[model samples]
Target: MQDGNTNTPEVETETATDWLTQLKNVIIEYAPAVIAALVILIVGLFVINMVVKLAKRVMEKRGLDATLQKFLGNLLSWTLKILLFVIVASKLGVETTSFAAVIGAAGLAIGLALQGSLSNFAGGVLIMIFKPFKIGDLIEAQGVTGVVKEIQIFTTQLNTPGNKLAIIPNGSLSNGNIINYSAEGILRVDHVIGVSYDADIKQTKEVLMQVMQANDKVLKDPAPTVNVSELADSSVNFAVRPWSTTANYWDVYFKVLEDAKIALDAAGIEIPYPHSVEIHKGE
Candidate 1:
């Protein structure tokens, strides 16, 4: 029984030694490849960062859109990193064909799960290509009127006139109507000024014309119009139309209205107020 116990211990020791020897052989064969892969990974990461930075710089110099610049830069960086990883795996003795098949399957699954995101991505690409409107443009879309702050891959940002920020989906924006107020260099400002029915219609028109002419921002070519548009119960309304550059549209609009009121007041033109007369029969 003692001999049997000693022989079992010897057999266990030999088995342990053989396992260690095989492990050491495997490590010896793969050590160089593993080290190479590590070096490539580190160097590739550094290079990929540099490439992304360089791409951004170039886009900036070329005056590309900020949204497009950021998206393209990130895409290039990710693609290069993925390719680098594949190369590293190959160098480390991984079956590249099987690895690529697994990656393809994962990509397919992700694509299926992100259908909405993919649609938005396609919309973004279409916007970049067609360029219906650009950043800083004042546009009305999706029931929101605002300045375009940014055009992102999945959404667009708008700064509303009320100082509110609106986030709109790119898919809807691309498919919907976008009224760009800033597209045309010039815009027409329309206003209705009312005067008492007793006031002289011709005199009121002259006063309005003078007001528009005095405002230097108003365009001279198209000229300004002052015509009797409506005769109402309380007052006669005149349509005042002026053309101004988009940049100075609001200034011309407000200035003309104020100046017209002052001119009419100085000329003794009456601006009537609302009035009602009530009568009671004898009881």
Candidate 2:
């Protein structure tokens, strides 16, 4: 009985040692595969990025639509990543046939949930392709007038004259009417000046033209014009039109208006104003 008990303890020790040895061997068998899978994952991602960049450069050289270039680049990146993922999974002894199906289903569900975001992305694509307006351009859209500050995948930013930042979704911006004030590089500033009917039309024209010409901001090539536009009951209205670079538009506008007033006053040109006539009755 004493010999049997000693033998049993020895047997138990052997069993425990065998179990540990099996565990170590199992780890040794799989460690290379795991390390190789990791290396491929890292290297594949780097190669995919480089390929995407090359593809974008090629598209740019071909003069393809900027939207298409970006979209294709992103699509290629994901496609390569999915392929790399499947390769790595197969290396790790995971059956990727079913894994790919699982990924597809998950993608479909995510797509359905992000439909609105997809619409905005599509809108951004259209905006980029159509070239309606660009950064630093003055634009009026969606009841707001401002300078375009930035354009992103889902939204656009604008800086208004009030010094406020306005964020507009690309979806609505792409669908709306966009007025690009800076498209022509030059803008027309319109002004209507009313004068007493007795004021000389020719003198008013010359005076207004001189005032516009005196300002440095107004464009001389187009030549500012002054014409008697309306012979109203109380006053004669003169249309003062000036052309200036888009950047200098407001400066020329205000300068012309103020100087014209002062010039008219000095030249004895009477601007019409309403007067309250009083009458006294005696009984």
Candidate 3:
């Protein structure tokens, strides 16, 4: 019984040794190719990193947009790295044709699943190229009105006048009509001023014209127009239109309104307020 047990132990040990020997032989046979593949991967990665850095530096030196620079740099780096990996795999006896087909299939599936994201990405690229709006420009699009803060590959960031941050998808922005208030140097300010129905319309118009002329910021070429637009039940409305530089639009807007009010009061124009009558009846 002891002899049989000893023989059994020796047989197990021999089997283990044979399996290890076969594994080592297989590794040795492919050692050169494995080393070559490893070297290629390491060198390729290093080169790609250097090239990407150089490209980024060049873009920076050119004073390109920050968002565009970052997107381009990352895109180039990822593409080169992926290509290097594929080449390295091929060197290591990997069937590159089958691998590429598999990768393509997977990419197609992912693209189909994330179609919206891909569309946004494409839209972002178009925006970067066309440059309809720049940083700090006040734009209204996609039912959002705000100052453009940052543009990324998928979305644009906006800082609203109310101190709120909004993120809008690039696809929506691209598809919708965009109103860039800052694009033109000048902006037209439109507002209506009301006075009591008994007030003299001629005098009110003259006072408003004087107020507009007094403000130097308001453009004179267009000639400020003050016309009787609507005759409401409580008051007479005058449409006041003035043109001013975009930068000074709000400043001139408020100034004109306030100055017009003071001028109107001095001219004895009465601004009527909404009022209701109350009646009491005996039951």
Candidate 4:
């Protein structure tokens, strides 16, 4: 029994030593490959990052659109990283074809789930290519009016006259009618000046003409027009139409209005106010 017990221990020790030796041999054989895979992954990620930074710098130096530059940069970085991951996985003896198939399936699922977003992205690309409106252009579209602040792949940002920001989907913008108020260099100012019905019509017209003429910003070629537009209950309405450069349209409009009032007041032309009549009966 003692001899059997001692032989049993020796056999167990031999087995344990053999197992250890085999494990060490396996590790020695695969260590270089494992290390190389890790190195490849780390170096590949670093190289991808550098490439992305370089691409972004080039885009910036070229004055590319901010949104487009960022999108492209991110896309390139992700693509390179994914490719590097595949290479590293193959180096580690992973099945690259199976990995690619899985990635393709996931991409298809994501594309289906984000159909609307993809449409907006396509629309944004079209907008960037055609350039219907640029940053700072006052535009009216899809029932919203504002100055374009930024254009992104999925949406566009607008700064409204009331100082609010509006985010509109690019798909909606591309599909809708866009009215660019600033597209034309000149804009027309339409105004109506009402005077007492008994006021001299010719004199009132003369006063309006003088007001338009005195404003330097108003266009001269169009020859500002003052014409009888309506005969109201208590006043004769004259439409004053003037053309001016868009930048000066508002300034000229307000100035012309004030000047017309002053000219009419100086000329003794009465501007009628809304009046109500009162009656009394005695029995």
Index of the highest-lDDT prediction = 3
Candidate 1 TM-score over all chains jointly? 0.80
Model 1 agreement with the true structure over 51-132: per-residue lDDT tens digits:
9999999999998877788888988999999999999999998999999999999999999999888888888978876788
Q: Model 1: runs farther than 4 Å from truth?
A: 1-9, 194-199, 216-222, 228-237, 270-274
RMSD of 3: 3.2
Best by TM-score: 3
Cα lDDT, all candidates? 0.90, 0.91, 0.92, 0.90
Clashes of 3: 0
lDDT of 3 by residue, 1-283 (tens): 3554555878899999999999999999999999999999889989999999999999999888889999999999999988998999899889999999999999999999999999999999989878999998989998888889999899999998797999999998888899999998788899899999899889999999999999999998778899999999888999999889877788889999999999999988998987789998999
TM-scores for all predictions: 0.80, 0.79, 0.84, 0.75
Cα lDDT of model 2 by residue, 1-283, tens digit: 3554565878899999999999999899999999999999999999999999999999999897665677778879999998998999999999888998899899899899998888899899888777899889999999989999988889989999897999998999999999999999999999999999888988889999999988889998898889889988899999999999999988988888999999999999999999999998998
- Look at candidate 3 and give me any clashing residue pairs: none
| Cα lDDT over the full model 3 | 0.92
lDDT (Cα, tens digit) per residue for candidate 4, span 190-215: 99989998899998998899889989
